[model samples]
Target: MTAPIYVPFQHCDALRTLAVPYGCGIDTVGVDPASAAPAGIPEPTLTPGRYLQEIRSAIRAMRALHDLLPPTA
Candidate 1:
């Protein structure tokens, strides 16, 4: 099987920043989800289900932002 793509921490941070309007928390955004469970990252103080819900909410927000932005020239 092919190896999983590993993103650098900086890139992960950038993604989080872009995804913020989607409802991602400042602290959670800093975390690399791929690395979180493996690196013994602590569970988000929030419930797992709630975290996922917020992520979904954030994605919707991002989509709205995309729709509102003018298309590139």
Candidate 2:
């Protein structure tokens, strides 16, 4: 993965297509070590620790929810 290039988080979605021509092809974006999301794109202004905690919590909830469902015969 390539190194990150910081950009405003507000422009995150909009800048993606626009940046492609500037040589920011999809592969050039790096994975964020903290959030495990794409890098270069600005991290959300929210607290990283809290955000990650919430993500993990949500995943656990989803797994638990799936487990609660009846298994296919």
Candidate 3:
């Protein structure tokens, strides 16, 4: 993985990697789903190359659209 450019901010006392440059968006999720990575369960893993490619693809798609999804009324 590329070196993290942003120092991780403590969230609930856990250090989480920052995806600033590549983060397309963020949404709240259930606690169980969020714990998978921080807990190191390792059931699902992505090779760095493939992961970066997917991230680039996602950012491109989002940029092409030119707007994020609207909030629910």
lDDT of 1 by residue, 6-70 (tens): 22333344344565446554322244454556566564556678657656655665566557556
lDDT of 2 by residue, 1-73 (tens): 4223232221343234444335443433545545665567664555778657656655655565456556899
State the lDDT of candidate 3 residue by residue for 1-73, as single tens digits.
Answer: 1112111212211211223435434432333333434575553444688567656655555453333334567
The local lDDT score (0 to 100) that residue 53 gets in candidate 1 is 67
- Model 1 TM-score (2 dp): 0.39
lDDT of each: 0.48, 0.47, 0.37
Off by over 4 Å in 3: 1-45, 67-73
Checking candidate 3 for backbone clashes, the offending pairs are none
23 Cα displacement, candidate 1 (Å): 21
TM-score to native of every candidate shown: 0.39, 0.36, 0.30
**Maximum-TM-score candidate:** 1
lDDT of 1: 0.48
Error of model 2, residue 26, in angstroms: 36
Residue pairs clashing, model 2? none
